[model samples]
Target: MSRPQQVLASYRSLLRATRIAFDGDHRVFMAARQQVRQGYETGRTELTSEPEHYDEIDKRLEHASGVALLLRSNIVQGQLMHRKANEEPLSTGDHGIASQSDESVYKLRIHKHTELGDNDAVKGGKTSLAGTAKKIKWSNIDE
Candidate 1:
C-alpha cells in the first residue's frame, strides 16, 4: 500500500475509535442521569415511606457510580490507544483497526456489565462491585 493509503487507514481507524468511545461515554452519562432521577423519585417522601424504595435508590446510585467509573477508565484507555496508534509508525500489514477493536471491546464489555448491574439494581439485587474489588486487589498485590 502507498503512504497516503496507510495514513488514510490510520485516520479512519482513529475516527472510528473516537466515535465508539464517545458513544460509550454518552451512554454512561445518560445512565447516571437516569439513576439520579430514579433515586430522587424513590427517595422522596411523597412516595410511600417504603424501605425497599430507599434501598432501590441506594443501589441505583451505587450501580451508576460504578458504571461511570468504568466508562471514564475506558475513555482514557481509548484515547491512549488512539494517540499511540497515531504517533507510532505502523509496519506493513499493521492495520490500525486492531487497536480500535480492542477499545471497542473494552467499551462493550463495560456497557454489558453496566446494563446487567442496572437491571439487578432495579430488582433490588446486589451488584458485582464486591467481586470487582476483590479482583482489583488481587491484581494489585504484586505491585
Candidate 2:
C-alpha cells in the first residue's frame, strides 16, 4: 500500500526468511554432529575411509557454522533496523500499526537468535567434553 507498509512487509518477509534459515542451519549442525559421532563409533579412523561421508559431513558442519555467524550478524542488523524504525514516528495510517508490528517482530527475532546461539554453544561444548573424555580414557589405557 504505502511506503511504510511496504517497508514493514519487506521486514516481515526478511524476518521469516531469517527464521527459516536459522532452523535449517540448526538441523544441519545436528546432523553433522550425529554423523561425527557415528563415524567415531564405527571405527572410521581415516578421514578418507569414506571420502564421500566425510566430505558431506564436513560441508554440512561448515555451512551450519557459517549460517550461525550470519544469524548473529543479522540479529545486530535487525536491532539497528528496529531502532531506526522506532526513532521515526509513523503517521496515522495503515502503515503506522504495521511499522510498530515490524519493530516487535524484529525484536522477537533478535531474541530467538540469541537463544539459538546459546543452545548451539551448549551442544558444541557437550560434544567437546565427550570427545575429550574419550581421549583421556584411551590415553589411560595406553599408559
Candidate 3:
C-alpha cells in the first residue's frame, strides 16, 4: 500500500482499538481518540514536509501499529459492583490497603482480545521471558 493509505489504515486501527479498549468509559475513550488524532496530524505534517525520510515514517507507522495491538490485547477496564452488607470485610494489608474482598467488587470488562492467563509469576505477577503468565481463572465478557 502507498504511504498515505498505510497512514489512514493505522489511524483507523488505532481508533477501533481505543473503542474496544474503552467501551464503557466515555472520558477515557475521548481522550484516547484525541491523542490518536493529534499524533496522526503531527505525523502527517512531518511526512509531508520531509518525504525523503522514509525511514522515520516507517518507524512511526510501526509504533502506531504496536500501540493498537497493545490497546486491543492489554487494556482492560473494570466497573465497580455494589458491596453486600452481609459479607465480612477482609483485613487490610500492612500499608492499609484494603483487600479485594474488603473493597467494592469489580466486574472486569474483559473483551475477546484481552490477554488471558493464570496468575502465576516469578515475582510480583510479572510474566516470564517466554511471555506466558500463570493460569488465571476468568470468564470473557460476551459482547
Q: Rank the candidates by TM-score, best first.
A: 3, 1, 2
- What is candidate 3's local distance difference test score? 0.74
Query: Against the hidden reference, what TM-scores do the models get?
Result: 0.26, 0.23, 0.74
- Candidates in descending lDDT order: 3, 2, 1
Scored by TM-score, the top model is 3
lDDT of model 2 at residue 8?
41
Q: Candidate 2 at residue 63, lDDT? A: 51
Which ranges of candidate 3 are over 4 A from the true structure? 49-51, 87-100, 119-140
Better of 2 and 3 by lDDT: 3
lDDT of 2 at 45: 48
Model 1: per-residue Cα lDDT over 2-63, one tens digit each: 43354344344434443443454577546645554555455454444366555554554455
The Cα local distance difference test for each model comes to 0.39, 0.39, 0.74
Error of 2 at 15 (Å): 17
Q: Which ten residues in a row have the lowest lDDT in candidate 2?
A: 134-143
For model 3, residues 1-143, the per-residue Cα lDDT tens digits are: 99879889999999999998998899999999999999988876767735687889899889999999999988878665566778776443221223254547556666567766555544555644246643533342343
TM-score-better candidate, 1 vs 3: 3
- In the range 3-110, model 2's lDDT, one tens digit per residue, is 335434434444444554344346654664555355434433443435566565455445545554454434432222243553665433311112345554332222
Worst 10 residues of 1 by lDDT: 134-143
